[model samples]
Target chain A: MIHINEQQVSLSGEHSIAELAEKFKPDSDIFIVNGYPADRLTTVSDGDRCVFIKKGETPAPEEFQAMLTARHTPGIQEKIRKARVAVLGLGGLGSAVAAALAKIGIGKMLLSDYDVVEPSNLNRQQYFTDQIGMLKTRALRENLLRMNPFLTLELIEEELTENSLPSFFHDVDVLVECFDSSQMKAATLRSVLTRMTKVSYIGSSGMAGYASNNSIVTKMLQPGIYMVGDDISEARPGQGLMAPRVGIAAHHQANQVLRLIVGEEERRRDEHTA
Target chain B: MNILLNGQEKECTDGSTVLELLASLKLTPESVVVEHNHEILQPEAYTAAELAENDQVEIIRFVGGG
Candidate 1:
C-alpha cells in the first residue's frame, strides 16, 4: 500500500516515483514523495506518501480539497473547512499565523493589514525582500495563493481602528490578533470579544527576544477569549523580535485556531453521545 | 468586596468598577484585557462595569511584541 496525495492504494510490485507517475499520471510532471521533490530514482514503498501534480495545471477545486482533507483527523475536515478565520495585522505573528493556517488548508481567511512590506519586516515576517514596498495585504495574498489556490481570502488594506474593526468582521468565526502594538492588540481583542459576540478571539503578546519557549503557552482567559505568549517581554535595544520566537507564537495562534475549530466538532459529537 | 480574580480569592474596594480594580493592581488601561463574569468589557465599558461579591474577573495583561 502507498499513499498518493494522501489517498492509499495497493501496488503489485516495487516502483520508483518516476515509474509510478509515468504509469498513474503521465501528464503530471511534479512528483513529491514524502514531502520532498522525488528524485528520478525515488521509490514508493508500503506506507510511503507521494503527491503528483502537473507543473502548470491547477487541479479541480474539489480534488484540491480532497488532497488536503485526506490527511486530517477523521472529523476535522468538515469543521475546519467551514471555519472563517480573520488575521489582524500582517506582522510577524499575523503573517506567520496566516501562512500556517493556509498551509494546513484553512478554507476561508480574512486578512487585514494597513502597512506595506519593508526591509525591517524581513527579520521575522513572512514577506520576502522582493516583496518590499508591496502592500502587505496584497503580498500575503499572493504568497498564500501560490500554496493553496482554493483558499478564499478577504483582504482589507486599511488601518483598523476600533470603530472600523467590528464592522469588518461580522461573520468571522475566529479572529486572531497579531498586532505589533500593545494598544492595538488589546483594542482588537476587546472589540471582538465585546462587540462581536459570536467570534472567538485569540491574541498574542511577548514574542520578543530570547526567552524560554516554555513560557509561551496558550491561556483560556474566559470561555471564548484566549491569549498566547510569555506575557512579560517587551521589545528593547538588544532584545528584538526574532524569527524563532515569533514563529513559535505565530504557530501557537494557528494551532489554537485549529483547536478551537476542531473542538467544536468534538463538542457536537459529545452532545450526540449523551 | 471579595471576588474571584484570575482564579484567586482577592479582595477589592466595595463597589469598585473594573477600571478601579485594574488601577488597584497598578495595571495601565491600554495594556490589559478585562473580562467580567465571562463577558469582555470594551475599553470604555470598564469604568462603568462595577463588580459585586463572588463576581469573576479575568484580567490578562500583555506586553509589546509581534
Candidate 2:
C-alpha cells in the first residue's frame, strides 16, 4: 500500500510515479513524492507518499494553501492562520522573522518600523532594491502579501516606546523583539514583561560578527520570554553583523514563535507525564 | 568596595550608584543595561540604585548593525 496525498492505495507491483499519476489522476502529468517534485519515470514502492500536480500548471492560490496544510500537521496550519504575531523593528532579524512566520500561514502580523529601507540593508534584510526609499514596514508587508495574499498585516511606521508598546501588544499573541540597540531591547523587554505579562516574547541578542555558528543558541529567558543568539558577541567598528549568522538567529526566533503558538511546550509536558 | 562587573573583579567607590559605576567605566547610561545581582535595573533607577560589595553586575550593550 502507498499513500497518495494522505490517501492509501493498494498496489500489486512496482509502479512509476507517472504510471500512478495516470492511474489515479488521469489529468495530472506531474508527480510529487513526500514534498519533492518527481519525474514521471521515478519509481515508487510500497509505503511511498505521492501528490499529483497538473501538467504545465503553476499552483493556484487555493492549491498553494493546500500545499501548506499538507506539509504541516492536520490542524497546525489553521492555528497558525488564526494567531496574531507582532514583529518589532524591520531590520535583519525582524524582516527574516516576519517573512518566515508569514510563509508558515500565520493569520495576522503587525509590522513596525520607522526607518525606510537603505541600500546597506540589502546585505541582510529582506527587502528589494525598489524598496530602498519605502518604509521598512510597508516593504515587508508587500513582500509578505506576495507570498500569502490572505495574510492580515498591520503596519506601524513609528518608533516604539514604553508608552506605545502596550497598544500594539493589546491583541497580539506574540511579541518579537528585533531592535538594533541594546538599550532599546532592554526597554522593550522591561515594558513588555512588566505591562503585558501575558504575551509571549521572542528576542535576539549577541548575533553579530562572523563567529562560530555554534555560539548562537536559543534560551528560555523566563516564562513567556525566549531569547536567541549568543550573549557575548557584539558588533563593533571592525566586526560587523553578517547575513548568515543573523539569518540563523532570526530563524531561531521564528521557530520559537511557531513552537509557542503550536503549544509545543505543553505537548512536551504531556509526553513527560505519560 | 570590589564587585564583579561583567565577570571581572573591579574596585568600585563605596556606596556608588549604578549611574556612577557606568560613568567610571566610560559607558553611557543610554548605551548599556545593567543587571544588579541578577535583577535587571530599570533605567530610571540607575541614578538612585546603590551598589554593595561583591555585587554581581552584568553590563550589556547592543550592537548597532542588523
State model 1's lDDT. 0.83
Per-residue alpha-carbon lDDT of model 2 for A94-169, expressed as tens digits? Answer: 9999999988889888888999999988989999999999999888988988877777888998888866898877
Best by lDDT: 1
Worst 10 residues of 2 chain B by lDDT: B57-66
**In model 2, which runs have C-alpha deviations exceeding 4 angstroms?**
A1-29, A33-62, A266-274, B1-14, B23-27, B32-41, B52-61
Interface RMSD of each: 4.1, 5.4
- The most accurate candidate by DockQ is 1
Tens-digit lDDT string for candidate 1 (A199-274): 7788888879989989888877556668899988787778899999999988989998998898841211111110
Error of 2 at B38 (Å): 8.3
lDDT of 2 at A236: 79
Residue pairs with clashing backbones, model 2:
A182-B62
- In terms of lDDT, the poorest run of 10 residues in model 1 chain A is A265-274
In model 2, the Cα lDDT at residue A107 comes to 82
